[model samples]
Target: MLHVNARGMKCPWPALRAARAMREADAILIEADDPIAPSELEALAQQQGWDFAALDACRFSLRRAA
Candidate 1:
């Protein structure tokens, strides 16, 4: 699994990093301390038609559609 370390990042940064990682991996685990991280990533996943699961309030896993 690809890992995107977005912990402590500000708004948009976590989403940007996750998007970049998606280019190279079908699945990715992202860790972000930002309170908005989950929602932002949920939006991204919807836009991309992917699957999104929150491992925690600050962590998420995104997977591309098969």
Candidate 2:
């Protein structure tokens, strides 16, 4: 598992960082206090065909398919 704290990070940075980390992980857990992070990450996961679940309003988990 990989954990990322993107609480104050904005836009593509969070998503980009998450994507990069996910590339080397089987699963990724991310936390972002910013409102845009959830949706942006969701879209990125969808576009990449990764499995995702929102743990709460500001937390999300994603898993790469093998």
Q: 1-66 in candidate 2: lDDT tens per residue?
A: 899998888887888889989879989999887778888988999999998889998889989866
Candidate 1 lDDT, tens digit per residue, 6-38?
988998999999999999999999999998889
Runs in model 2 deviating more than 4 A are: none
**Candidate 1 residue runs with Cα over 4 Å from true position:** none
Q: TM-score for every candidate vs. truth?
A: 0.96, 0.90
Most accurate candidate by TM-score: 1
**What is the C-alpha local distance difference test score of candidate 2?**
0.88
After TM-score superposition, the amount by which residue 4's alpha carbon in candidate 2 deviates from its true location, in angstroms, is: 0.7
RMSD of each: 0.6, 1.1
Best by lDDT: 1
Model 1: how far is 4 from its true place, Å?
A: 0.9
Model 1 lDDT at residue 28: 99
Which residue pairs does candidate 1 place in steric collision? Answer: none
Q: How many angstroms is residue 37 displaced in model 1 relative to the true structure, after the best TM-score fit?
A: 0.8
